[model samples]
Target: MIDKILNIKELNYASSLNGDNLKQKIEDLFERPAISFFGNFTSQTEFAAYDKLSVISWYVPNFKRKSAYLKGEILKSGKGTLIKLNIRPNTMLSVASIVSVLVGIIILIAAGSSTRFLIVGSFFILVGILYYSFGIFSRNRLRTNFEKTLDLHKV
Candidate 1:
């Protein structure tokens, strides 16, 4: 069995076993994610897995309460097994985030009228960027950590 990361955000490769067997092995490797503390915050960092699918999520320390997660699916490809992972953010939060960034741009454009708008707009823009960035970072970090923990790259 050979595993490879197609990109920083996705991991997949070829396996000789069926999807059920492969998924079980992954579950065994991680066992269960531990709860860790950062300052006064106690957050859960873990994934839920089944025979053909897995969903991974963890807490982000950002001021805004946002959750990040990834979904993986196993499929049969040719004579081998193929596993793919991706983030689907078509939710309200994702939409609001994009709107925030656009609103920030509008505020900046209206800034010539008042410095107050500039300040507010800047704040919005910063928050929007952080929200978006944290979402991406969280998803990738979890996937990377999983691969590293299991030494999948070399497998």
Candidate 2:
């Protein structure tokens, strides 16, 4: 039992090293504001197929934190990527809304007298509205978080 535990611990350490190395490489390649870390944490009681799996999950936060630092460095270096990550969700929401609107129009034309078609169309409209609203909310949240981070660093 003790041997098994030791092996698991070693595996976890090795897995963490791999993640750290990968993050370091990304930082080196991006060279500043182009990177941001993302982390995931699990309850202590959670068990995975292997120790390595658990380590990767735990290491995500560290990677994200480092990425945030990288972002700052890039901002200071003035060599950061022009691309922004937060816009994708909004773009996706817009596309989905357009598609939903088109589908609703098609259903209205095809159904003629069927109430079910109306119901379906309304459902799609509702979904599209919710998607757009959620996207806006997400954008606001990201902005708020970024502001908070900047404030913290300022102090």
Candidate 3:
């Protein structure tokens, strides 16, 4: 039964699910082939004080042969909240960029004041910045293409 469903040309044939239901459905499909989920949570605090609030908590899944899925919740603290859309590669790239940036910062800080060490440290920082920016750009372009493909299928 699963194989037959998988072989079909159209996987997202059912359009009734949206929001939370859609999220659940995608999560349920993770056991299948060539699919994985990426989870992220972001919080914001006012004035760097004790009032910390979770702004977004969500998961995005990218499938090998199907449209990528977005599933998550947004906490409405003010005017409104937004669920992250069109984010799969973007999430991965953002993670990569963050890791690279942190490493670069640490290296540069440790190098401190020495001319030779400063040169090497600066190189690392430059490389990190390049990698981070490239990753972000690639992710955004990939996401846009994926979204276009999804829209095409819906028609």
Candidate 3 wrongly placed segments (more than 4 Å): 1-86, 90-93, 150-155
lDDT of 3 by residue, 1-155 (tens): 52221211221222333445444443444333432233333333100000011112353354122122233232232333323332322233344455666776777788778777777767767766665565444444444443343232331
- Score each candidate by Cα lDDT: 0.51, 0.36, 0.38
The top-ranked prediction according to TM-score is 1
Estimated TM-score per prediction?
A: 0.59, 0.41, 0.37
Report the C-alpha displacement of residue 54, candidate 3, in angstroms: 33
lDDT for model 3, please: 0.38
Clashes of 2: 7
Better of 1 and 2 by lDDT: 1
Across 1-155, the per-residue lDDT of candidate 2 in tens digits comes to: 53221111111111112333433433343333432323221222121110111112344443321111111111111332211121112344445666777787788778788999988877877776775665455444443443343222221
In model 1, pairs of residues that clash are: none
